[model samples]
Target: MGNCCRSPAAVAREDVKSSFSGHDNGKRDSSVAAKKAPVTVLAGVPKENIEEKYLLDRELGRGEFGVTYLCIDRGSKELLACKSISKRKLRSAIDVEDVRREVAIMRHLPMNNSIVSLREACEDDNAVHLVMELCEGGELFDRIVARGHYTERAAAAVTRTIVEVVQLCHKHGVIHRDLKPENFLFANKKENSSLKAIDFGLSIFFKPVQMRSNVVVLWPDVAAPL
Candidate 1:
């Protein structure tokens, strides 16, 4: 899948900050100083800059609603990956509300070894940018294919992690009905083989009892008649 890059419209959604620290002959021109450098700032890029924020160089991944990127927060100089969800794909008005609710879910989620938790959110009229922990290890799908199918023990271990995530979601009254291999990712294999679940495209926060459609999609294993 192709990574989502910032489009002209998306870029226009933030207030980006620019700097001009370099100068020729070690001299600061008075005229230039008075001009304030006419900062080429984007309205949404600067999305509530809290300090030490990082700019994204390239996109890391893509999802149903948006794209993910490896970014650097300039304040602490820490690396983070940002998942930006476009307003368009969040079709239903109710689905938009669910995205906000999911953010709350991320905050309440425990800092465990099983899944990824959101760090912060950047908002604008066009999209919702989620800052999350950056995983250097990459996705589990790539790893599995490279090493062939996992051994019984490895599979069992991963399955346990999956269960933990599902249990957490259940506790929060949310159901990630779409559980698949591609959604699982590894943060660092050499340091620690911890899995971080990504993608909340089909996640629902309300109970199945509240929505009849939820009951139908609960069983994803069986193919539905075309």
Candidate 2:
């Protein structure tokens, strides 16, 4: 129990030799410093906010609660993805709490390696902007459809990475209930790149004493709820 919270930009410092090595490198503080708790205010987008920091390019996708866009940092010119969720979309106080919990989990997750990293978090009068690493390599679904089939070794290697991700999430009490093939992505446009788990909107936290849920979840290769 090192630190459970931090600013969206600040993260723990754990030097590791490699990722996907399947080695127990031990754990360290990796939580965002919990703040005074400011829920994303329900309103419309203000004139100025993340727009000043990022140059929005195109719409990646949209959902009932939010819209994700491809963007570039104005200062660094770095390509990134920004998820903008409208506060007005939340139906009740519980919905707000859900968003807050999702953010907390995303921030606390060790995302520097096996997962897509959340680069920054900001909010305007209308929505909260979650800046994350852009995965231009496309979805695992696309790759699977393109390849058609894989050798036993290739399949096992991919399976091992998936297991590592689930184990990592469960170890930290977070459950990615809505896991799916479309939810995972590669960091770059390389055939040998590692996989990254993404989209934690339906994820939840559980206590060690809690019993597992029997409900079936439609993920890629494994069950979602344990």
Candidate 3:
């Protein structure tokens, strides 16, 4: 099997094409390697020890900024999601303004049902890690694609929460320029399934009289004029 556990090579050669090829092999090796590989220790963070803070056992997802790991706090065994932004991107962006904005927003955003709870934010010399509650129910987009379409009642139920969240964001002078299914996550896996809005990468803040530019260009028709 290809190396499933993270290695210097996997981290260095992170790309979609190469990733799929290695995935199967990695999956085969997951169980054994998981027992052998020590969980990554988050730096400059509080709590008795970082290990007790989070136990990164699996790779949940990944993005341009970083990867999300399914972690469990040792003491409570409570599941959590930890996103680690790459060191390369930290220094890669010429402006580095977006990173600053994201961290600031996470720190300032109010805790409510409308958004994902930010448990902690930590940074070491190489990366910034944002720790949040784990949502096992999966992404809204995945559900939509799997089910094809929602019933009218289901659609309304989901849309109502989404609209409320968006309205709250706007009220706080923040604009979720990108509103899509993937960004919505299911909080409770069972009966009372709830949506927890995730990611603010494309979000921008604006005052009452201010207008923010849309960072996401869905298509040419809606693309901002250059």
Candidate 4:
């Protein structure tokens, strides 16, 4: 994931190649066109333009299949983040299923101060947009690098917060496969701002009877205190 705390002065755009192709004899193939149609990543979402509700501003970050932008609600003028995933990038059935599962898992989790909240989810003809609360304080990895070393109390507090987040996910039958300093962000730039887990792209719902080999782990190397 790209850093979301970068300056949003410049806007960025990504161009994707169209999957459809013209016939050899200058005629279009209707059947092939239908086969290459854009996949609907999210179900039950009305095909409404995302720009109608939120004004997408400068780009904040870019991932493999989507871009995160600084957005504002047109009605309330509240600042938020919009993560738009392009349907063209979801080439395979597994890729499409992963995107759908990500949205479902985020919505399935209960409200918590330690987890970033999803405001709304909208889908259009081209992409699926996820509107969420914006965290501007930057990633935990950067914070630790700047501070050089952490005090005993500060380290303990950080450890306790991370454990609580994991416990909460387990309670909800959701396992966050990716947990690291880069995945955690402070709510604001304040000294005592709450740290929140921001990404769930790799999370999945698990049952107690499931085999241990089904779990995926991406643990961080925490040789010393953060």
Candidate 5:
């Protein structure tokens, strides 16, 4: 792919993509769209600016939709990862609506220890807030870079954990379009810590059977197109 300016007619569609995006009109899934409410959105990144319920700290990282900040809840002093997504960053009305669907998915995703938990959502005119559990162990690639290499058993363990996560997401009708070492993080700094999948900004929800076509898997001895 070559870098080029997007014409007015060819606005980027990746922002609106899903596994079943064969004929997307930039609308939310019908099931979700039906329940979407019409409401004004507010904006702000920090806790004070958006709300005083939490105290926002320095940036942890940035994603497709916004920056992630470390926050401490006032009442419980619970550490959290808040994704601050600016309304201006949303490319179109559809992008704005998708934000709602995204938040809903995060909040209601089946309880899983390997997935980051979304605690709450706070919104203002400036941005939409996605408050999530704080995972401080950092990205998987960082761990690998620090350790240099791993034993075969350890590698197999990590691979198995990752495969299970992918299976879980697919079972929920979500396709995490962007899955890389940079997106998976450990729960803590332990020799055998488990991993958690984060950053659902590019994930899309589809119907149950929509993902059955076009798929493949690779094993040590053979590459199979499923």
Candidate 6:
């Protein structure tokens, strides 16, 4: 129970001892400690100041580990959504790996109208930022609830879009583990705005054979696994 049950003050002292252990003179190497302290969530992403490139506006949404902000590009003045995931909230190695996999999957997928495009991913000491296309319409679930129901044609259209997205993911050897209306968002507030699949936090890369075991049927009675 050395570190596991150590008090905050004891932990701080232990950290101080470890930091100066490398030096015979007992002086800590600030640069060495700084370089080794921060965790790297995304591989190959150079550390950059996110604020210099984008202005993080009002928060659009919040989840357990991160916040989605309305980000504006400083150079082109383009509107984008920035999902900033706090490093502090990444409580374990698995949490950090999940973020890395999500970013990798998004970058691996080909550009498609049915999927939200990730513009860029950057990180600093505090957080990992994912800049993606802004979908202002709203969640698909909310729209369905507000309208009470969808017309036969509208329902069919939505179904087709969702199927297409799933197909695209399977074609590229990726499986979106989480699929639901809440994860889909409309690109705009128009009546006929295109729906895009947004969240890939739970997605994973798989082999073609793995697809058979992972059955995803949008309509249980009528739909077959693709």
Ranked by lDDT from best down, the candidates are 6, 4, 2, 5, 3, 1
TM-score: which is higher, 5 or 6? 6
Q: Which of the numbered candidates is closest to the native, going by highest lDDT?
A: 6
Per-model TM-score on C-alpha atoms: 0.69, 0.73, 0.72, 0.82, 0.71, 0.79
lDDT computed for candidate 1: 0.67
What overall lDDT goes with each candidate model?
A: 0.67, 0.72, 0.68, 0.80, 0.71, 0.83
- As for TM-score, the candidate ahead, 4 or 5, is 4
The TM-score of predicted model 6 comes to 0.79
Clashes of 2: 5
For candidate 6, give the lDDT of residue 216: 51
- TM-score of candidate 2 relative to the true fold: 0.73
After TM-score superposition, the amount by which residue 206's alpha carbon in candidate 3 deviates from its true location, in angstroms, is 1.0
Provide the clashing-pair count of each candidate structure.
Answer: 17, 5, 1, 0, 9, 0
Model 4's TM-score against the true structure: 0.82
Per-residue accuracy of model 1 over 142-170 as CA lDDT, tens digit each: 88778888889988988888898898877
Clash number for model 1? 17
Q: What is the Cα root-mean-square deviation between model 1 and the actual structure?
A: 10.6
How far does residue 34 in candidate 6 sit from its true spot (Å)?
Answer: 11
RMSD to truth, every model? 10.6, 17.2, 9.4, 5.6, 12.1, 9.9
lDDT of 4 by residue, 121-205 (tens): 8887678888999999989999999999999999999889999999999988888888888889999999899999978888889
Runs in model 2 with CA error above 4 Å? 1-48, 214-226
Model 6: lowest-lDDT 10 consecutive positions: 1-10
Arranged by TM-score, best first:
4, 6, 2, 3, 5, 1
Output the lDDT of residue 3, model 6.
20
lDDT for 80 (candidate 2): 91
Which candidate, 1 or 6, would have the higher TM-score against the true structure?
A: 6
